[model samples]
Target: MSKTCLIVDDSSVIRKVSRHILESLGFEVTDAENGQEGLEKCDENMTDLILLDWNMPVMNGIEFIKALRARSDGSSPKVVFCTTENDVEHIREAMSAGADEYVMKPFDHETLQIKLKLIGFD
Candidate 1:
């Protein structure tokens, strides 16, 4: 089966950009505008990976990761925080919260593809 991915970001442009990129890499994509919607979607579908954005209107990426890690399943989506948060502290916190990977924003298509491949998702 084709791997599925969830793109969670508040910006429509970001979501669309990520969806197009993942689709080109043969991933089936689902999307949500914020962490609340993302969590709901996760419950509805077990995604192979999640491309999450920090600083959203509803719940943020960090909050999402915390809740996801609290689940009884003991495993959540292989999440990659795809955001503009370049601060070391934020990155460290995301890592501590159980994100599988973190990618800073302003990423090119090649960089995104490389990260996905490194995670064995591409």
Candidate 2:
């Protein structure tokens, strides 16, 4: 079966762009407007991978990762922090929160694909 991916970001444009890229790479893509919605969707149907954004109106990516890792279902999906936060501290924070990889914003298909491959997605 094809792998599933969840794109969590407040920006509609980012979600749309990520959905297109992930779909092109053969992923069954789903989207959420914020971390809360992302968590809700994950509870309903766990994804193989999650592309998360840092800043949002509701819960942030780090918060979501922490909550997801705390789940008892063993649903540890590969999480990639896709955000504009490129500082070292933020990256370390994300890793500490259970993110498998990181990707900066305004990424092209190649960069995203590289991250996916690094996380064993393709």
Candidate 3:
């Protein structure tokens, strides 16, 4: 079966671009406009991987990760923080929040592919 991926971001353009890239990579892609919606989606149908953005209106990526990790289902999906927050401290904080990897915003196909490969998705 094709792996499922959820792309969570406040930006519609980012979600669309990520959906296109993930679809090209053979992922069954879904999207959410913010972390709260993303969490709801995840609860409804667990995804194999999550490409999460750091900032949003209702809830943020770090908050989402914390809640996700606390689920009783023990569904440990690979989470890659896809955001513009490139500071070292923020990267460390994301890692500490259970992100499996990090990708800066404006990432290309190659950069995303590398991150997917690192997470054993490619």
Candidate 4:
């Protein structure tokens, strides 16, 4: 079976781009526009991985990560912060929040593929 991935982002463009990339790489992808909706989706489906955006409305990535981390063992998805926030502090904060990986925005297909592979998603 193809691995399932949930993409949480407010931008339609980012969702479209990520969907295309993940599909091309053989993943089954689902999407949510914000953190709350992402949480709802999580409750409804089992996601193998999550690609989360940091600056979304109605619950930013940090809050979302915290909430996910607060869940019981079988409830949380493996998450990677895929965001525009590139500062060292931001990366550290995401790591501290339990993100398995972090990838900066404006990434090309190759970079994304490599990062995913490095994280054992490929």
Candidate that beats the other on lDDT, 1 or 4, i.e. the better one: 4
Residues 30-120 of candidate 1: C-alpha lDDT, one tens digit per residue? 9999999998988888698899898999799999989888887527468899878799999899989888888888777888888887877
What pairs collide in candidate 2?
none
lDDT of 2 at 25: 95
Q: Residue-wise lDDT of candidate 3 within 1-122, one digit each (tens)? A: 88999999999999999999999999999999998999899889999999999999999999999899889752579999988988999999999989999999999889999999998987
Q: What is the C-alpha RMSD of each candidate to the true structure, in Å?
A: 1.2, 0.9, 0.9, 1.3
lDDT of 4 by residue, 1-122 (tens): 88999999999999999999988888899999999999888889868889999999999999988988888843346788998888999999998998988888977788888888877876
TM-score of 4: 0.94
Write one digit per residue (lDDT tens) for candidate 2, span 1-122.
Answer: 99999999999999999999999999999999999999999989999999999998889888889999999852579999998888999999999889999999999999999998997977
Runs in model 4 deviating more than 4 A are 74-76
Each model's lDDT comes to 0.87, 0.92, 0.92, 0.88
Which stretches in model 2 have alpha-carbon errors above 4 Å? none
RMSD of 4: 1.3
lDDT of 2 at 33: 94
The TM-scores, one per candidate, come to 0.94, 0.97, 0.97, 0.94
